[model samples]
Target: MLQHQDHLALRLALIANKRATVVRLRDERRIDDTVLRRLQATLDSEEVRLSGGAAVE
Candidate 1:
């Protein structure tokens, strides 16, 4: 049973945040590889938690 929806909401929020960050960085005419990697790592980590340690993709 999926009791709490926090994880799902957090995942959505992270996606929105990543989108915003990408747009901002793009408009600034510079992409920070470190920042992008960090965001991706955070997303992947959260997804792993959601999937109960199952492989993502």
Candidate 2:
């Protein structure tokens, strides 16, 4: 399991990725729930692996 600090770090990493993706995609002026959900799911999977299956609130 990931320590609390590690979990926090993972969350921060995911947030950074999301923000970067948003900025990169913003010029398209198009976004959908499916896209956002996919991004979130990808992050969640990473977090689960990084945290040893335990997710932080």
Highest lDDT: give the candidate number.
1
For candidate 1, lDDT tens digit of each residue in 7-40?
Answer: 6766767776876787588568687767766767
Candidate 1, superposed: residue stretches over 4 Å from native: 1-30
Clashing pairs in 2: none
Task: State residue 9's C-alpha deviation in candidate 1, in Å.
Answer: 10
Error of 2 at 41 (Å): 0.5
Top candidate (TM-score):
1
Q: Local distance difference test, per candidate?
A: 0.72, 0.69
RMSD of 2: 4.8
Candidate 1, residue 18: how far the Cα is off, in Å: 4.0
